[model samples]
Target: MINIFKIAARNLLRYKRRTLLTSLLITVGVVMVILFSGLSGSFKQMMIGLITDATLAQMQIHKKGYVSSIDTSPLNLNLGPKAYGKVRDMLEKNPLVESYSPRIKLGAMLSNYKETTNIRLNAIKPDSEIKVCPALPDRITFRDRESGQGLINPGEIIIPDKLAKGLKIKQGDTVVLVAHNKEGSVNGLNFTVAGVIESVAGPQGKEGYIHIKDARDLLRIDKPEVTEVAIRTRDFNRIDMLYAEINSALAEYKNPKGNPMFEIHTWEALSPFYNIARMIDLMAMSMKIIMIAIVLISILNVMMMSVYERIREIGTIAAIGTAPGKIMGLFLAEGFSLGLISTLFANAIGVGAIYILNIHKITFSFGRTENLLLSPSVNFNELIWVSAIVLLVSIFATIQPAYKASKMEPVDALRHV
Candidate 1:
């Protein structure tokens, strides 16, 4: 084995420039695959985290039929107080349950005293969002730094900064929320502007925030009813288990409505932005496959040229009684050596590049909203997998040239030169 490798190394050194060119091809392929996989994978994770932590949380439980008719933001389809309490109790007792926040989703008219426009509002508890969504408060741009988590109080609300700028409203200003009750009766209430936050996910989902009490009062709901419960888990990967537990624990409280009092949805189901992220992941895998194809073609070209140039040498060794299998092994070793060396260099370069990018906080916009931070993750197992595939493909590429060299007729070998 040592002798075979030494012979292969000698042969490669004889054609140093060709060998370097082949190795460089393999190196480029490896580096491209690693960088694409890392960037795409990180983008998917970042979008998921943004959606879950900022808006969706890991999961949500809504009244039956509520999500189906979500566009209407129907007030009649609400989880009455009894059902809300039951769900909250079930969430509290479960080990998988981290933190949950009850929200009343409402569509209302907003008036800055001079201008009125349509807006969506989420009425919530002032402090319940602490563990549930710590990022939510961290992203509150226009709030006083010390105001802390959740809505400030009744008659105070949070709006998106872009919307606030357009409406020409600011902190401590007054905004009026006018909405219709289930009976179609129009009701109006005034709220002080508490804070402004940047919108994540997209422009369409930008909304205002208010205390639940004010939402009920403005909408004229005689009793406490919630539209949905946004929930967060300590580990988002356990969402499946949490979903099952929620359904199992709430089985006793079934409603005639198709929604059955409460139904939970994972973040993926709640947001559509994930579809774009998934497409990026598919593109990454496709690029890696393309890299393998490039490796096969480039190595085959180099080995074929090497075999043709060394015809006399192959004939001499065959005439002296070298086995055909050994001849094949020599070429295979050459190809393998090139691939192995390239793989090492590529991995090192890829790792360093990712480190530099993350340290510098490299960012690019995924779609419309700008300022998404680049967070490449190292998948060492994937790196190993890619290297193995490249090496194997490189060896396979040598088969035709190696076979031709091994089968050269000894008598015809000395004829040409």
Candidate 2:
């Protein structure tokens, strides 16, 4: 083994350019995986925080089939007072249920009389919303008074700053919201602009927040129907635990219609941006595959050339009684050395690149919100995993070429011109 490594080292030194070029293919591949993984992870976390912390809680309970058509914000699919009461009791009984809030989501037209635009209306209880999203009240920049807060009363609406400027409306202004209820009847509500705020994450542009009672009145829902219940737990990391507990408890329970009452969703399921996150992951995987292909092709070509060039050398060694296994090990060692050398240096560069990017606080916008920092993040385990994969690929790529060199006839190779 020692002799094989020495021979491999000497051979690599003999063809410095080929060795470096071959190693570079592996290096480039490792660097891409490292940097892309870090950036993708950071983006995923940011999107999750924006959704779970800013808007939807960690989990939500919605009527079955609600998620498939969540875009329409269906009024006909809702939790009636009886079902709502039962679900609330179930949540209250569970120890992991840190807090929960009910909300009514609707698509409506908000008009300042001069300018009119469509808006997503989120009807929430100010008190409960604060518990789930503490930053909700703080996001309100403009209010009727210095001490004003979130949806203090019905007939009061909160609009985003972008919406406020676009419609030329501000705090204390009056607006009309026109919406259609489940009964297919159009209804209108007049509201006083209580505040203008900014969204923390998920979707951009104009949205409105109103008191739940007002939503009920405007939609003519007298029986206390709720579109969904947003749920938060003690720890996000342990959300799966709570989710399992809730599911187990509710497994045997059914609605009066003998159907599944509700479906549980993590923030990922509720947010469309989660698909974007998954796509980013797929892109990283594709990049890694491309890197592998580059390394595989480059190493295979170099190793094959080495076999052809050293045909006489192989015959001379075999005639001197060196084992065929030893000959194959020599070429494999060269490939392994190339992978090991490139991976170490490439990973080092990748780590440095991520650190610098995070240090500079690079950022870009998604929809309407601003100042989304592009912070790259990585971990030690992933670094080691990438290295191991590269090394294994190096060995696999050289196998056929090394075996061919080992099988060369001593007489035939020695007679080559």
Candidate 3:
């Protein structure tokens, strides 16, 4: 084995320019793949985080048929006190649940006294809401951000930035919200604008936040019911498992109509942005395919050229009793060496580039979210797999040419020119 590799190295060194050029090509391809993977992976993760942690929690539990008519914020489909108690008890006992927030969703008329417009409202307890959606407070633009205030207090509202601007509403401005209860009773309440939240791109519109107590008073709900329970899991990667577990647990709790009473959904099911995440993943796979093609073609061309140029050498070695298997080993070793050298250089450069990106604090905006810093990184396991793929493709590409060179027989009388 050692002798075969020694011969291979000598042969590759015989064609220094060609060997270097092929290695450079593979290196460039690998580097491009690594960098693209890092950037795309970071972007996809950041977008998912924004959609899940900033807007929709990792998962949600809603009364059956609630999401289908979620656009209307149907009061009749809410989880009654008994159902809410069951859900709360289950979540509180489940180790997977990091935090959960109960919200009362409703549509209300917002009036700055001069203008009135429709707005979707999510009334929630400040403490639990912050735990479930930690990014919510960062979206507030009404008060001095430096001031350490919670999301909202009783008699306070956090309006969307667009609605605030359109209504000429400012911080501490008083707004009136008029809403109707399930019994069709109309009621209104005055609230002070505590903060303004930037509109997040999702299945939400002109949305605002208010204290849950205010929602009950405005809607005149005598019973303690909740529209939905947004939940954050301790481990995001295990969300699907937890979702299934929760669904199984809730299966026995049925409505009077003999159907399941509650439905659990992951963030992907609740947001349209999941489609974009899928597209990013597809693009990353395409990039890997392109990298494989580059490695295969570059190694194949180099090995085939080596075989043709060294045909006389092959004939001489065979005539001197070198085994065909050893001859094949020599060529395979050359291809392996080329791939290894390129992969090492590519990983070094790729990691350095990622570090530089972090150092520079590259920032860009997605949708209306701003100042998002790009922290591109590749997992160590991913790096190892990429290297293995390049090496494997290198051997696969060299097989045909190596076999051809090894199968050569001692020429007739060694008379060829």
Best by TM-score: 3
| Per-residue lDDT value at 327 in model 1 | 90
Which candidate wins on lDDT?
A: 3
lDDT of each: 0.82, 0.83, 0.88
Q: Across residues 101-157, which tens digit of lDDT does each residue of candidate 1 receive?
A: 988889999999899988888888757755666677755665463645444688788
> What does candidate 2 score in Cα RMSD to the true structure?
3.7
- Residue 275, model 1: lDDT of 73
TM-score of 2: 0.83
Error of 1 at 357 (Å): 2.9
Error of 3 at 290 (Å): 0.9
Better of 1 and 3 by lDDT: 3
Writing each residue's lDDT as its tens digit, candidate 2 over 1-417 gives: 777788788998899998888777678888989998898888888777777766777888888778788779899888889878978999998888888999998888899988888989889988887777655665676644655543457988888788888889979999999999999899999999888877555642245789999999889898998988888898888998998887776665677788887888887766778789889989988987887788788888988999999899989987888788888898999888878788999988999999889889888877766778778887788798888888888899999999987898888889977
Query: What lDDT would candidate 1 get against the real structure?
Result: 0.82
Candidate 3 global TM-score = 0.94
RMSD of each: 3.0, 3.7, 2.0
